[model samples]
Target: ADGAAYERALERHAGLAKPPGSLGRLEDLGARLAAIAGRCPPPIPSSPAVVVAAADHGVHAQGVSDWPQEVTAAMVETVAAGGAAVNAIARTVGARVEVVDVGTLRLGPVPGGVHDERVRSGTRDLAVEPAMTIEECRAAIGAGARVAAELIDGGADLLVTGEVGIGNTTASAALIAAFTGAEPAEVTGKGANLDHERTPHKVEIVRTALARHAADTSVEARGSLGTLASLGGLEHAALVGVMLAGAAARIPVIVDGVITGAAALAAVALCPDVAGYLIAGHTSAEPGGRSLPDRLGEPALLDLRLRLGEGTGALLAVPLVQAAARVLTDMVTLADVTKTA
Candidate 1:
């Protein structure tokens, strides 16, 4: 972020007809956009696109989520067909939704428009073994970077992170605990209407995975990639790559729910600079999502108690993001409003 550009934006904000800080976070959001675009009045973000990265998690076998592993592939198909919540929200916001199959098990026929970049059919159960090989994890990250590049190259001015994978919240909780030093019980949440009776079991599963990768889980250990490879799902790794690419491109990437927040944890771990490029679209109902904004130094733009992981929450916040820049560019200045005495 450039300090000069930010100061210039603040100056412009003061010059606006409204009182200083009248718009609150909106004023701050505009200034940040100016810093991001390297100008006092940043260009309004247009042509937003949400990339839905889909995969199947081996943790599904651990009885963590009530939804079966097959639902991962089925929902990927729904996203590809533009039938999912992300699709409708993207449509409402005039953003395109791109579904990518990073890795899914038992996928019969992939619908058109969904890119096929499967790292593996599905990750191995993290409780018993590492979810993915180091190479596989790297490849998945590379795939996300490629997807971000393609979308930005295709004229997408902003990127939104979305993920679809059954049992992914288990992986997310484990990743959050690993990165934030939060207890598994504190970060874990009941996913997919998981019965209260089994929530503690899910927490234990995350604890087990974190314990298995204890050496690599510490932030000071400088083992972010190691931690991801050991416990992350393909979609999570890809989201990290996407975030890195967005930062490299200087495009804002709005993060979705707990699943996306987990990816963000890994991304910020790998490259702390990526934090400057991220936007917390909402505070997810999940405990992990609730804690992520503070870690990223950005407050959530909305709090819809959203728990869906298909980028739905992020997509809903697109208009607000666009509004921030629009206010800077379109609002009247005090000089314009006041006539000469």
Candidate 2:
């Protein structure tokens, strides 16, 4: 059913006015997104929601990230104050930003518009222990799903998943490896500009954590919250739930960089069909991020050497998607292009 819907969607757009294939990949994005919604002129999500999940990670103590743990909360504050890149980009695209605090250890009042669903103080250090307790992980997933469902039910036609947490990318890469069965080195990256001196060390730390938990992860199934709790961040777990909800709601989700990608990978593992709702935003410059999902054949939309995990890349591609949707919706049929006798 999904494949057929996507096929006719592409066919309809390609048959629209203007030269065939003139609109390039955009026509494709629109057609696929529309098929996901199973509607012509699928809702453009006039007020698309960018759900930014913020949490702290004990892994930051492992020297995995160049920035301090405080940066996570500080940046969340900046995002709420409209000073972050996602804030600027979402504004340009007319999308609303909603920040969620899944497990910021020192959480206080978030901005009025942000959601506070703190499941725990923060995740445990993966280097010395699992990032989250199985129960905490479950709650985070439920929180994320609930957020996405609420946004969709409130008429958000599209959802862009984003995240913030200084050391969360380290958590994301670890999840990608354990879930995707890829090597830790293959999924780890130079997060937040880890100096050349520290990049390798950061990667090694992830490696050690993986080895210590090797038997546990191998024994776990990536298809449930337990798998996530064993090797993922609170934010990632929540994002995975959000993706699952978005898929069920027939909303297209623009996945951010490595962190968001990690969440999407877990979603795919949990519910393979949820991938239909995801649009690969861009290729992350994070070390092996580009190849993280080599098993999935679709290529990313952009590659401007971005390693940021703030969903900035997804926001950057929002216009392309909107433009594509416009093409499908506004284009006249080829038959209509001819004058009547």
Candidate 3:
């Protein structure tokens, strides 16, 4: 792919565009992706779709969240009701949000427009057994990817990955430990505004969960994605599917927070080349989220210290990406840049 040459060409192309650097990083991003796609100018993003995968975690019974286990179902309703944080942000960017019940329990008629993509009622108790069966993990991942395929087919030019399962951070912490060699405490964070002091103890608890799950002999053969399925919340699994689907389809995906970052890690582990299609939307205020972009070798597009995980951060990032895409397609050449310069 002439990786080095493509990068160089992108820089030259960006400089040749009108206004020199008025558009900032967006201009750089557009040019870079254009070269990667072997296009002088790339398509602009008008219809971006953000998929929110929600589920309840078995580990929540262990007291990992400040919010109740029931909040999973409640928040799913909020998203469907169009009153959640993500809904507001998606509205701002005019990106559609779809909620998928990847593996939640206590399910009934899911809210209208919510996809009943459940692979299981819920995962097994990770403290006592593997969280999910290998088949269930694969099914959940497939569900997410399939949802992404539908959205992309619906004329979406970009995809943003988000999730809504509580306690998933515990799984993310464990995955981060395995992938980044960071201790659980190093990667764990205070989810949903728990006491700042309790965050450290929360990390220790996840460390314990990882240790408890280590007895599962099938995990190693299961791959990182499988390992996450063994401990990850349903939304995490769906995000992994979304990441893989978006990468395979070559749609740029904006990652929201540490949870999404963890999913990206697992997705890349499943397909090492998937990282090429990812954009770290913002550094999450989640305990170990700040470390994610560096883990992926990319800088975040925003840093307002966001911690909400329902794709809010990623949806907020759409305007910037759109601006970037616009730069490639609409910006003029240096010859027409400006006489003021």
Clash-forming residue pairs, model 1 = none
lDDT of 2 by residue, 217-312 (tens): 443423456667767888998898889888888888888788888888888877888877888888888865665335356777887778777788
The worst-scoring run of ten residues by lDDT in candidate 1 lies at 213-222
Total clashing pairs for each candidate: 0, 0, 2
Instruction: State the lDDT of candidate 1 residue by residue for 51-170, as single tens digits.
Output: 999998888888887777888889988888888998889999999998889999973766678888888898999887789888899999999999999999999989999999988888
TM-score top scorer: 1
Q: Each model's C-alpha lDDT?
A: 0.87, 0.79, 0.78
Tell me each candidate's TM-score: 0.96, 0.92, 0.92
Model 3 misplaced stretches (Cα beyond 4 Å)? 1-5, 8-23, 35-38, 219-222, 337-341
Q: How well does candidate 3 match the true structure in TM-score terms?
A: 0.92
> Candidate 2: where is the Cα deviation over 4 Å?
107-111, 217-224, 291-295
lDDT of candidate 1? Answer: 0.87
Residue-level lDDT of model 3, residues 142-224, one tens digit each, is 89999999998998878998888777777678777766777787788777746666576667667776776666565443567
RMSD of 3: 2.4
